[model samples]
Target: MTLFGTTLDAEQIAALLSLLALLVFWLVVLRRERGYARWFKQWEADRKARREAEQAAEKRGASPDGRKGPWG
Candidate 1:
């Protein structure tokens, strides 16, 4: 049969559509995965930084009797 002034049977059209759908689906999934990974990495870094800061503060805070601890 004729499709868009060219020859393309129903099977050929179906195949082309399937390929396009698959390509688009995979591309979107991969892109999303990459975005998620990047976001997770940033979150991890921020969490680590905050944890380190808290630890440092705890170490630098006054002792039970209000005296500078070892890390002075």
Candidate 2:
């Protein structure tokens, strides 16, 4: 077959298509994984900050619900 003014056999065309598909697949997978990694990092940071805040509140003699009463 002719492609871009170049001749390619059936096997060559098939190999080229396979390589293109693999590249696209990996690109999509890597993009999604990067987003997941970013989200996880942010989640971890927020969790750590919340834990520190809770500990600070406890040190200040405050309950988790912000009430010093026995019910809290």
Per lDDT, the best of the predicted structures is: 2
Score every model by TM-score: 0.75, 0.76
What is the lDDT of every predicted structure here? 0.91, 0.92
The regions of model 1 sitting more than 4 angstroms off are 1-7, 62-72
Every candidate's CA RMSD: 4.6, 5.7
lDDT of each residue in 1-72, candidate 2, tens digit only:
998999999999999999999999999999999999999999999999999999987778855566766665
Q: Write the per-residue lDDT of candidate 1 for residues 1-72, one digit (tens) a residue.
A: 787899998899899999999999999999999999999999999999999999989877847666664755
TM-score result, candidate 1 = 0.75
lDDT score of residue 39 within candidate 2: 100
Backbone clashes under 3 angstroms, per model: 0, 0
Q: Model 2: number of clashes? A: 0
Candidate 1: residue 38 Cα off by (Å): 0.3
